[model samples]
Target: MPDSIAPDALRRLVLPDRVHRSLYTDPAIFDLEMTRIFGRCWLFLAHESQIRAPGDFVRARLGREDVIVVRARDGRIRALVNRCTHRGAQVCQAERGNTAGFACPYHAWTFGLDGALNSVPHRQSLPPDFDLKDPRLALAAVPRVESYRGFVFGSLAPGGESLVEHLGPIAAVIDNVVDRAPDGEIEQAGGVARQEYRGNWKLHHENANDTLHPGFVHESSVSAARGDPRDYAAPAYDGHQTHTQMLSNGFGVREWQSLSLTGFPAGHSYMGGFYRGGVLSPDRDDPVWREYRARLVARHGEEKTARVLGEDRFNNLLYPNVSINAQYQQIRVVTPLAVDRTRVTAFCFRLKGAPEALFHRAVRFLTNLSSPASMILSDDIEIFERVQGGLANSEPEWLDQSRGLGADRTEAGGRTVSAGLSELPHRAQYAAWLRYMTAAA
Candidate 1:
């Protein structure tokens, strides 16, 4: 356990447009975050589609606690601690599977899918006072579990804000993801791609909404794609480079401009310009794209369908832990393993009832962009490690996120809107980070 630091001292670490490097490297600060942020905030769990059948379960983690998200025989989903109450041993080992119940290998103690104490060996030999209904004897459960459009979340805190309230304006972005499904459903299509980095987890979420770095950091990949061997050494490539060219090669340079970045309360934000011009204009001519669009058009009018498809926010930062890209049909979950190590898992989602080719396209994007060995992502991971190492030097105590500081304007629902290249997303995140880290538990 880490000794608690005064809240005022913590506040000084986070400034309006700058933050102390210790926030990313301090073990004590990381411990406090595990309690204050991860413990209270609603963190994304397995999707509802993952546990469709009774007795189906998937292993998950809430901060430091290992949990099992299972569908009970009674058709209810529950998140239970994976530890056995009797001897403190893990009860479930499978990553995900269907089972009648979990039997602890340590003592043969059994728990039902709903986490109820179902059986114990040597019943007659046990103490007469042993009570099966005791709360401590049953498999412990997460305090709260909820889902929005099949994306499930669990909270360790007993009470705070509901999942919808926590999501706020970001809920619309999530809706864009699910609503894109022709039948209004999305499922885990392919297995997840996992990667681990020797850097803080916050860097991953911060980078998700950082649009200013792509043109510079990924210039090699872009140059390779564009067949231009010229080095990206000029200042023009810094923050003024072509936005569409910085993204995947599928998008044409003339098709779009710098994206719109929106930052809302609770550290939520999204960045993309493709929402205006549309993401799949080329795919518009494909049979798979046409078939899927027709289904959506039948359900919603042609105008509404076009608007939904065009609302292409490339990456959505779901606060502290998850980054979702609906356009790519990928959800990336960040797990902090230590003060300096973080693990990321990217899962591919398939729009239910959409054409098979559409699913294949999603997988191709996942492989080419989000995979651990991806050309684009490898550059990001390398930079994160470099940044982590650079923070260790004894020179600058604060990191600057001053780009577009005063340029952001307030929008409806208290959201802050600005050009996609702005650092408003990082500012929004640190604002929430300061609040959560300093607030009373």
Candidate 2:
């Protein structure tokens, strides 16, 4: 914990319907979050597909810690701190590649693919009492590393909930995507889209499931796509218009009734926005959709295939870092760079045994929507930057997140749910954040 923001002080940063600005801009708070939240949480590291063969490795970041996820010769996946034990210099410099082991360029210390100490320069120069069996000679490994359906995650904390328990209801959401594969296997395909935004990381977290902003924030883009020119200079909605009982209608006037947001424990939540087009319809005449449906039916049977393909969840916020968009076959990994900067990498996946056209469609969907040149993502990033700037002022000490505050209902398994556009997701996230942020380390 940072001495600047003690545990007791952290409690004051959050309230029932608001959060202190310092939580977004304070360096101390960010450091505490890296330790208390990211350090302990099961953070997404690497997909099994990224390290499919022995000696393959990919660099990963869990908050402030740098880790290397490697496939060892023993056919086991291992995650180790990137630092070399000899001089605390990073052993691996490449972002990712297949290598027999990592050699620290600084001191020529070598570690095996599994992070075991392999050799050191000038062995004869060592003291007589020195022993290679010393654990300190090996690279430090993360305390916990586990995978759920090929998605690997690492935790710095020794133990608590298993990976499956941390995922909670989102586990079903993940299964819904992986099961879409005809062979029940999914692989990272095509390529990755990396982007950086000058905004607080929490902004993206809140914006992921924030339904209230789409119709307004993306209004210009939507109008452009429709070949209609909507006034962009119109004043924002007045408080009266928003507070009207008829307009509220319990969920605060949402445009998509089919859209639903559900909050689960451990700060996990999902936004269900089934594919708007006829993409998932088995009866669609499109050759790609027809072929994909047939392959799924052959593997999972007609009834089961329907249920699997029909699930079109938009964004599943796994909390802290990763967001999965099953509808588009995309997984976005969020990495915080600073209190005011964040980096996001979007990966597209292909369902094994699916047709080439299906993979092409998946790639096109993510490229058009999540790529750095994407208009949708551009709008989101712009808003995030603006929000960060706006919050720097001292006038508004509290940001209101009270939408649908009293309208949520408790569901089975302790999930809190509300209708479309409700702020239940935000409330649920902050509740978990406070619990994790202030809890004993």
By lDDT, the best candidate is 1
lDDT of each: 0.82, 0.80
Candidate 1 TM-score versus the reference:
0.92
lDDT (Cα, tens digit) per residue for candidate 1, span 345-398: 888888887887777767766766678768777889999999999997866999
Model 2 misplacement above 4 A? 1-4, 228-254, 276-284
lDDT tens digits, residue span 396-436, model 2: 78888888788888889889877667777888888899989
- In model 1, the runs with Cα more than 4 Å from the true position are 1-3, 228-257, 275-283
- Clashing residue pairs in candidate 1 (N, C-alpha, C atoms within 3 angstroms): 275-312
Error of 1 at 344 (Å): 0.6
For model 1 the local lDDT of residue 436 reads: 88
